[model samples]
Target: MQPIGWVLLILAIILIIIIIKNFQIVPQSHAYVIERLGAYKTTWSTGLHLKIPFIERIAKRVSLKEQVVDFPPQPVITRDNVTMQIDTVVYFYITDPKLYAYGVENPIAAIENLTATTLRNIIGDLELDNTLTSRDVINTKIQVILDEATDAWGIKVKRVELKNILPPREIQAAMEKQMKAERERRAKILDAEGDKRSQILVSEGLKESAILKADAIKESKIREAQGEAEAIMTVQKAYADSLKMLNEASPTDKVIALKSLEAFEKAADGRATKIIIPSEIQSMATLAATLKEMVSDKNIDISPKSEQQAQTTETNS
Candidate 1:
């Protein structure tokens, strides 16, 4: 082959290589920053893009997907002068590829430094206790600060988290002891409350039992009184029934007198300080005694008269 033909073939090969190099395929969730003659030109999104070889070049390939960065532990001093190691995790994403490429020299290093500085500032304002307890507040403050600071760099700080906050070994031991003591105190209080509840329940049960016993005693007394009342009524009814039958029979005065005597005998059988007999009863008693004496004298005199009469009649005959 001739020298000019070989030179032409070499130029064609170089041109083909340049064209292939100029073609770019931006992948999903990715961006490409283009620079024209060392100056910012444009940003290419996810798709095929062409750039003039040797004139326009890709300055940076930015990933638009959310990313995570865990910074190393930083030594921080609290307001109370307690030193501790705190590590942070930041979640971020690229919002603008052009700005992220040209806005800062080392964006990741800038973010790490900013995070450290912000953490120190926040820790400086809080005591050890507050620093341990206020994780959410610290995280929110850091996120807000980082978002505002990184906005010009085309990065959006989605979230910031304190991954770990490690206190001194001595302080950790002391905290463990304090937590143990607090738990024991709570346990004692709970036990006391349980005992108090048990005592109250027992007292209530005893009170209820006493009330039931009193009610039972009261019911028994009421029943006993009712029984005595019924018995008295039965005795009175029997006496009334006997009196009614005697009246129905229409007894003579003598019989009534005898009944009265029987009633007086019954009254005498009972305990009494005095006994006052009625005038009718006194007259009946006196008549009974006089009749008894007259009958006795009649009997004695008849026997004697009969004997004397018999003797006198025989003498006269």
Candidate 2:
């Protein structure tokens, strides 16, 4: 190769290197802080940017997206002098790349220190119980303070959270025991309430059964009384019908006397110590005995004798 050709090739390679170094493509959600002549120049956003190769350079690449930082546990004392270890997580984003590059030497380290200091200040005013319970209050206070303080550094604190608050080992064990006891008590109370409800349901069912049974018994008694009354009415109606039939017959006196005799015969069949006979029945019985004697004698005339006895009975009456 010729020397002139070699020199031309080296110049072409140097030019390519300068072009590659000077031109930059900033990615999305990122900003490049540029410094020219050892001073802040401008911030390059998400686009192609050109800079003088040696005079202007990227000082820092600041992410514009929201970011998370998990700080280590910081030991703090409560108002009651109880020492605890608490860790924090911060959500932040850069608002200005120039300020982020020139505002502070180390923005993350400054934020960590600020978080620890603010946590101590808030926890120191509360007792052990309050410090354990009031995590939200502490988080809000820390977030407000950090946001105000980091504004100069082009950082906006979106939120602060206490990742963990670990108390002493003995206190943790005691809290676990208390929680277990409370759970057991709730279980017992629930069981007792269930038993009470079951008993009440059982008693109500029994009471309803008893009432139904009583109602059935009452209905049965009413049915029995109705049956007895119906039987009595039937018997009385039968007696009334018999009397009406007898009255409609319009019997003669002889037929009436025969009927009376049949009644007397029926009464005589019973085991009565004494029986009273009416005077009319006695006269009829005497007349029947006389007629029977005359018929057996064969010498007495029945028609004339019967006429003479009837005349005598009528005159005597």
Candidate 3:
């Protein structure tokens, strides 16, 4: 309630506010660059930090997390005097907050300019074709150079990528035409190979068919020959059996003569230009004619007595 007591309480409140403001808390993946008396002091990492209110101040707040920066397209000349525009992307992280805060006035701007200059130098050594094709080589070279150059600035270049390489319209058209022709050539080669393979398969199939046909023919001929052999054997066996049965039957001379006559008759029935009769068959026919004439004569007796006398004469002859 007194004036001095009120003034003392107000001063205590102001001091407390100032002290609390001086107690800084650095967050994760961040650092604080502290300067004492407008000179280099120390870097504060992620934790509670206290600084003198007017003498010690935070010069810069640096993020320790990886950062990506895409630089604008820079016009460059190749070894072949071809002009092109290429943009790049860089990945970096802060390593030392103190160096980053004091080493360069604008670190991002410095990196962009450095990247453009390095790109031009590298492109100057390569032809238009090599520059277009060798992306990995160019990226590695740029990353290495940037990492070394940015060491003093407390930055580490992790990766460098050529985001876009824009060539002239004419060059792009020519490349597309060349690629189309290459694809056509490969397609023709594949078609030719397929045709050749199909022909080989057809020829193989024909060869197999021919082989099977020949085998069938060979088998048919072999079977026909075997059948012919068996037929001949059967005919010969039948003829031999007939001869055996005939010999087993005992017959008189007249019966034998009749059988000979039957055989001669069978031989005469064929279409022969010439036929020769045996002398014995001719004599037997003459005797049969004489017997027939005697049987027809009226003076000759036709009884068994005459028949017996005729048979007795034939037997004696």
Q: What's the CA RMSD for each of the models?
A: 12.7, 9.4, 10.4
lDDT of 1 by residue, 1-317 (tens): 99999999999999999999889999999988889999988989889999998899988888999999999999999999999999999999999888888899999999999999999999999999999999999999999999999999999999999999999999999999999999999999999999999999999999999999999999999999999999999999999999999999999988887776566446444554333444454346554454335334333111112332321101111
- Alpha carbon deviation, residue 160, candidate 1 (Å): 2.6
Q: Across residues 8-76, which tens digit of lDDT does each residue of candidate 3 receive? A: 999999999999999999999999988899998898989999999889999899999999999989999
Alpha-carbon lDDT of model 3: 0.84
For candidate 2, list the clashing residue pairs, or say none: none
List candidate 2 segments past 4 Å from native: 1-6, 208-317
- Residue 112 of model 1 has an lDDT of 100
**Stretch of 10 with least lDDT, candidate 2:** 308-317
* Global lDDT of each candidate: 0.85, 0.84, 0.84
User: Residue 32 of candidate 1: its Cα lDDT?
Assistant: 88
- Using TM-score, rank the candidates from best to worst: 1, 2, 3
Best by lDDT: 1
